[model samples]
Target: MDKNISFTLKIWRQNGPKEQGHFDTFQMKDIPGDTSFLEMLDILNEQLIEEGKEPVVFDHDCREGICGMCSLYINGHPHGPATGATTCQLYMRRFNDGDVITVEPWRSAGFPVIKDLMVDRSAYDKIMQAGGYISIRTGAPQDANAILIPKPIADEAMDAASCIGCGACVAACKNGSAMLFVSAKVSQLNLLPQGKPEALRRAKAMISKMDELGFGNCTNTRACEAECPKNVSISNIARLNRDFIKAKLKD
Candidate 1:
């Protein structure tokens, strides 16, 4: 049986993107060990509502760790203290009976906090819109086996495709660089045959937009990979650099 535990939550509170932020303390008592972090927040919100206090604002959707909407910095780690997991997947059992857990939004200039724990991650969307897709006309959807992609290449592409566009990389990076995220996005498509035609253009455009959006340059620190929920590799960044250089050389 899972035992209940008590803890103190110091969660960041802010009214808007331009407003100053600070931590608001709340006492959580007798919470089930199996309760997910988000569920615990829900209970806290319920308590606040009953007491007529304003509820904490946070972003979440598809709590199964797919959408990457539950971006949070718990105890100085992006997405709590779990390895290869998102904040929604984090359970209370990870913490002891009386621990002070600090929760904050992703602290990056590129990802400005919108309210409390939620930030505007639409910068990622803008990067994607810059050149994350294959626009060439393929007349019809071909059968899966028709393309004849080798096992190794296909596997690498699949691994790169696993990136969920979570901004944990930005939050974990000391430079606030989006190289890991941008590289993963570029690699997944560039490694495939359908995306080969415009690979050079894709690399240049996405990287340009990332810079235009104020994301810092990659400085070889692997902090982003260390804190990534999907385990996206830094090697993709190397590949991105090679492609970007090739694009520049051709110009």
Candidate 2:
């Protein structure tokens, strides 16, 4: 059986993007070790409501960690101390009694604060819309073996596709670079036969979109790869750079 723990939470609160924000402290008592981080927040919000106070606002969806909606900066880590796990996967047991836990939202010029822990990640959607996909004609489904992608290449593509667009990369980087995210998205399609048609166009368009949105340039800090919940590699950035240069040469 899991034991219960207690902690002091210092959470960032804001009324809106243009409003003032500050850290509001609260004491969490007797929280179950197995309770996920979001659940503990639910408890805290419930207590605040009982006291007739406004509940803290944060973003979350599909607590199982797939949706990547839990964009929390916990205890100086982008999703707590656990590696390759989203904020929703963090559990109370990761803490100790009387520990002071700090929680904040993703901080980046590209991701403006929507309220408290929620930010306007719609910039990512705009980046994706710019050129994140291959334009394929509608027809009957193609046979799986017809494309005949090698296992190693397919695995690499899958690795890149694992990115859930959580924006932790931007949150952790001192430069707030989205290279890891964009590179991963680009590489996923770039390695396959179908995506090769627009490889140059996709690379140039996506990188241009990323820059137009005010995301910082990559400085090789590697912080994004270190803090990524999906363990996305920095290698994809190299591929993206190569593709971008080649595309420019063609233009």
Candidate 3:
């Protein structure tokens, strides 16, 4: 049977990157349990608009667990208490009636507050710009199996490729590190044949960009892997370290 539940929401609000921010509490009544977390926010925003108040600002796109745009810290957990799920995939049923849910943005220097829950995650884009690319010959369409890859290797690469660049790992880490994100990108390409040629270059360049963006160091607490919506493995980080070391040695 389906039912509705009420919740007390304590959501963070900010005007801009340089402005001070604070939490504003609101009462949500009789919300459908099957409603997604983002949909619940939509309801609150609609109420605020009707009241002639500013609607809470947050990031979201493709609310179907892809795109990774729904980045919210709910009740001290990135993307809420659910494991392997994005905020948009989180249902209101996970909470009880009268629960106080705290919502905030990703709190990393690399991701400064842009408005309320939206942060300047362009630092991630910069890191990817530094190396997340391949140099392929201008080509006609090739056969599907033109390059025969081992099944296990292809599967591993696909797993790493599943990363949506959500930055949940950074939000969940105490150090606000971005190792898991960088490593996943690095690993996905490194495991494939075409990426091998530039593997060393990609590793060093991306890591350097990540460090330059004011993101913190990885403490190996595994918080990143635990919070990652895509479940990107920490083993990729090991591969990244090795690749970085090898790149340095080559230099």
Candidate 4:
């Protein structure tokens, strides 16, 4: 059902990384049901600019949810209250007409707020470069049938490969653990035949890089799985644990 909502928005505002931040409130009337969370933010920004105030700055790219750039901590929930939905996919209809929504950036030591709602998640990219991808040759690529991966292994790898590295797992976790994200990335490669040659190496290198980046340890609390937009299994974390142990033993 389409409805117009009148809500009060409380958004975090900051000038830069070292600046003191505060919550700024704005009220709007007749917000439509079809307006996305970012769309709502857009409306608020337009209003703020009209008032000669700086608009709240947040990260967003490819509003279709693939880019994983719309990292919003909305009303105490990462990516708002929508299950399996990114911030860009969140609509204002989910909120009450008189709701006061609190919007902020992802809070983690590794993901510090750069300005207002925009944070630096490039730490994830650094960890990936440390060891998230497979190392293939510059020579001719193998044929699709050359690898001949069995269905079960391929499917499992695909499932793990679905991780978007959105860092929701880290944000939702009490200890700020990134096990789900790292595990999925590691397990995806480890599950496949093509990934076998560097399986142990990949596990060891990725985990080491993760630790070096100062990500907190997992305590099995499962807040990560609960908030993972991709629904990545915690069992993959177990797989990473086992792989890490095996790699250490082989050292």
Can you tell me which runs of candidate 4 are displaced by over 4 Å? none
**lDDT at residue 79 of model 4 (Cα atoms):** 90
Cα RMSD for candidate 3? 0.8
lDDT of 3 by residue, 57-157 (tens): 99999999999788999999999999999999999999999899999999999999999999988898999999998988897979889899999999999
Instruction: Give the per-residue lDDT digits (tens) of candidate 4, residues 131-160.
Output: 788888798877878778888888888888
Q: Candidate 2 lDDT, tens digit per residue, 33-110? A: 999999999999999999999999999989987997889899998998899999899988888999999999999999
Compute each candidate's TM-score over C-alphas. Answer: 0.98, 0.98, 0.98, 0.96
Q: Tell me which residue pairs clash in candidate 4.
A: none
CA lDDT of 107 in candidate 4?
A: 81
Q: Which ten residues in a row have the lowest lDDT in candidate 3?
A: 135-144
| Lowest lDDT 10-residue stretch of candidate 2 | 141-150
lDDT of 1 by residue, 1-251 (tens): 68999999999999998999999999999999999999999999999999999999998999999998998899999999998999999999999999999999999999998899999999999999999999966588879888888899889899999999989999999999999999999999999998889899999999999999999989988999999999999999999999999999999
Q: Show the lowest summed lDDT stretch of 10 residues, model 4.
A: 140-149
